[model samples]
Target: MNSSESNENVKEASSIEAIEDEDPTVLESSTSETEVDAANTSSSATEGKVRKINTETFIAEIFDYKANPTKWVYKGSKPAIIDFYATWCGPCKRVAPIMDELAEKYKGQVNFYKIDTDQEKELSGSVFGIRSIPSILYIPLDGQPMMSTGLSAKDEYINQIEVNLLKK
Candidate 1:
């Protein structure tokens, strides 16, 4: 083989090796974090099913709050859960799967949404005053939002949805 062709092959081989040599700790940390969040979120709704909301069409289906600067209006009708999270946050990763499960389980009853702090910083932070990751805000149709931090058990989430959201 010519010198140039041999060098290209060598470069490709090294790149693959570098990727394979990544630290296991980094991978474990991320995986465990996700697992933890999922465990916490799923704890509450073990029996209840949840529904997932599409970010792009959420406004059209639910309410047109996108044009409003406040981004929230308590209509006193449908209860909603807004999850503020970041991709790199360990706790956020842990809670994500649980959120998905809850969304599927609670499909038409309670609205579930995930807002990425890194991507929607201004919209999420400025409007919601989100100071930490894994912050869950439960908004009832008529009253103020009840905010909770950290990982909550599955039962708590289910109760919150049934009592606070579904009842109304």
Candidate 2:
């Protein structure tokens, strides 16, 4: 084997070792919504809110649908909230921080994600049928997503999530 070939082999071996050494409990620690829910239920029942979802998993796990014409398909164990907004929109800017706050507060219960309409134009406009800024979609595990437009209050979002998603 040549020098370059030996280097490639070493790189591959190191990559494999890294994957093998990864802590198995990391998934249970950060990704498991059920565990978070259980802890919230037993401890701080009222304050539990929105869970932050990993971006890659959000795309892979959640089903995609086109706007007006297409329907949402939810097949996950936990419910989710998908925020459709643009950077330039003023109201969207207002709601962004609230979304972030909820993401941390509800770290394990409900998965949350934001899709930039400006960046993901076809996705926000054509796919999700978002005609306005700050359109929030609440997707329960079994049912269709409930769509709400405009700048909603923090309590309103929490109430909808609790009643429709978490209560189930």
Candidate 3:
């Protein structure tokens, strides 16, 4: 890749690494950090299902990224997986069923959520600095949240959950 592309990758890397720093969650999808619209949010996302989470729900359940940009503390009783995807993305479509299966498999053990890059622009682009689709934010019950981009096998997700989240 060119230098500019490489630099952009570095920025994205830094954004993801910020999660490791303080485990923050600010999905600056499109607009600037201060431009996010904080609509009414609820944390009523059902478990064991691939639920689509809006920006508000994201702030409520996962992290109040708008309010706390510098530090992110997960507000969930269970481990979580936030899948960043788009309706038009082919690879995202391919990964959806796998996520669904994994969600059902984990059920009460892990919470699975999908963030639409097209719908939540500020979240996908700005908060997370996601330049591509199928980026996953794996949040453990404690410690730092791990980021995995691109598509992978179902076993990989299982491994991530078993090793990363559950420490199994």
Candidate 4:
């Protein structure tokens, strides 16, 4: 084989080696909401706060779902809200502060998460079917998660949280 072909082969091998060397436990712990929840529950930490979640964390903490194509199963102990947004989107920027306020108001009651759509394209597109910016997913303890796109009023978000998550 030529030198260029040999170099390509070495690059491929290095990539595979990198993947193999990653620690599964560390990866799981960081992304697993269950683990985080357990730790939080045992400690005296505050709740109802907002956090950033990636694809792994979404699967581990939020939904704990599998590759099943037909069923939706939520694995969280409390209700959750996931904001799907992009950095450059105006609507997303407008909704961010409102979400933060809501998180503070509902602290220790609900969980808030943000996913950058640009960074997590597969999760935004295939998993959540997100087609627009500032899409919010409101998940209750015992029902299907609802999705809302575009910018919404803070009152509207409050109403949804109360009705859907708080049930008050």
lDDT of 3 by residue, 1-168 (tens): 333332221112222332222224333334323323323323344567777778878877778876767666778888989888766667888999999999989988998888877688877777777765678888888876767777777877777778778877
Q: Model 2: clashing residue pairs?
A: 50-106, 66-127, 67-126, 67-127, 67-129
lDDT scores in order: 0.52, 0.54, 0.69, 0.63
Encode model 2's per-residue lDDT on 1-168: one tens digit a residue.
Answer: 333332221111110012121212111111212222221132233223433332234445566332223344554566778776665667878988898788777767777766665555555544554556677777777756666667767877777667666862
Q: State model 2's lDDT.
A: 0.54
Q: Which is the leading candidate under lDDT?
A: 3
Residues 7-71, candidate 1: write the lDDT tens digits.
Answer: 22111111011212121222111221232222234324532333332333345443445564434
Q: Looking at model 2, report the run of 10 residues with the lowest lDDT sum.
A: 9-18
lDDT of 4 by residue, 46-148 (tens): 3555676677777776664455444567777878888877766777889989998988898878888888776666677666656566777888888666676
Q: What is the lDDT of residue 3 in candidate 4?
A: 37
RMSD of 4: 16.5
Off by over 4 Å in 4: 1-46
Error of 4 at 7 (Å): 57
At residue 92, candidate 1 shows an lDDT of 75
Rank candidates by lDDT, best first: 3, 4, 2, 1
Error of 2 at 98 (Å): 0.9
Clashing pairs in 4: 33-61, 47-108, 48-108
